[model samples]
Target: MTDEPRRRGAARTDELLRVTLETAAEVGYAGLNVEAVARRAGVGKHTIYRRWPTMAALLLDALSRVWTTDLDYHDTGDIRADLREQFLRSAPALAAPPIGPVYRAVIAEAQADEALRATLHDRFLRTVEESTLARIKRAQEAGELVSGVDLTFPAEVLCGTLYYRHLLSTRAVDETAVDALLDMFMAAYGT
Candidate 1:
């Protein structure tokens, strides 16, 4: 009997998250607000506030649900090939609708909001960077990459370059660009 309330709460949370994404897609982050999301979700504002203290937090959670899979790298015994596969797989999400715009919006807002910036790094960027670093470390252990090297910069560059292109430049992060990045990484780090 007690489980019923918890299940309902979980279901309501999922519904709210879905509505939040839809609202962000419809209006962009600048137009998103707690009251608006609550109204759109057919719930009161307190419902959202109870789950997330701020709209940024809610948006982060919504984005996290959809963006998790691409952050993970496959261990195919070849670091270059595995990274290439993961980067290619993730490129579309950064360039396409739904996730891309909301992500860009959050990043832009974070530039002015220190709290949001910290939360963004803590919640999202750290996960991506950690995953990339872990993959590289594994490759190093297996002798696919150079030994005794500080891989942190390489990992950051690998992820940061794509984000820079996606968020700042007019250029596309197509296959050629990804290959070029991988080629550089291999030239620098590969054994």
Candidate 2:
């Protein structure tokens, strides 16, 4: 509750997230357990268990926290440009070193764990969909984009393709690819 305790809590949470990322990347999804993360993070087993109720929950948090990409933005008045900017900035984070492996492992784990998959969809993918849909609707109302454009398509294409490439492609997801993907999506629906 106090400042010092809060600070320590925040720092410890950060450490736990980092250790999970490293451990997940190194040992992979099935191999990742809280005890190892606790030992690596130099925290007690209770620290992780207290914060996250389950192993799937902890890994989901680690993936969400450690492999972060804050795609938030103030509307720039041009919907296409805003979307492009978001992709350009956040796409690179996907291809970055430790985050990529952490992401891959979380996704892999999610495949086997129904609960983890649902949590990830709720936490990450749903938020993205809602945000993009809202922005696209705003753009439509503002006359920045054409009406009746189903916002879902663009959001799905942008995020889905990025993940598709990240998980499958031998080539890295880069700035140019992000720009191209945005362009392709925009061209389909933009006024």
Candidate 3:
């Protein structure tokens, strides 16, 4: 039989993750209190501490739930169309206020916490890079990226453009920006 303590621990951890994310959504990272999470989860504060031991640990796990793994890469024969579709899929989450602030907070926290940084890098950031890179490489192989262009750079440009547009520009990242960015990337980089 499985160990009783380990099974209970796992259940408690899952409950905490649910409560933590819900609380994070209701209150931004600055207001994400451990006591609040414990109360929401219906678990004791010591139980949370016994599991995560730190707020950052709990926060990172909560952020991980933000990504929709169901929305993986879609490899249409047309690379530009595929990339556009991927961007469209991501846009809803980007459009969410809770997602934007939560992601920003997690990114800031990751910058300082080595362990959290690794978790974010491995779980979220790396997955995005890998998915995007796969699409870029497919585009290149299909002769969409011009022979002289640096494939990786175009992928970076795509992500960088959208991120900056959302994070800095006063203009909203609507369909116009998405279509424009895709057109620019495809025209300049497409073979």
For each candidate in turn, the TM-score is: 0.92, 0.84, 0.79
lDDT of 2 by residue, 14-110 (tens): 7787778778878987898988988887668998888999877877777677545776755989887787777667766777757777777778778
Per residue, candidate 1 scores C-alpha lDDT tens digits across 29-107 of 8899999999997778988999999999999999887774567899999999999999888889888877888899889
The candidate scoring highest on lDDT is 1
TM-score of 1: 0.92
Tell me the tens digit of each residue's lDDT in model 3 across 1-191: 54544436667677678778778878877788899997887667988888777888777776666565354678777887888788877876755755676776666666777987788778766667677877788777777676655566676778778767665566767778889998888777777
The candidate 2 region of ten consecutive residues with least summed lDDT is 1-10
Better of 1 and 2 by lDDT: 1
Worst 10-residue lDDT window for candidate 3 reads 1-10
Model 2 residue 153 CA deviation in Å: 3.3
Clashes of 1: 0
Please give the CA lDDT of all the candidate structures. Answer: 0.90, 0.77, 0.74
RMSD of each: 3.5, 4.0, 4.5
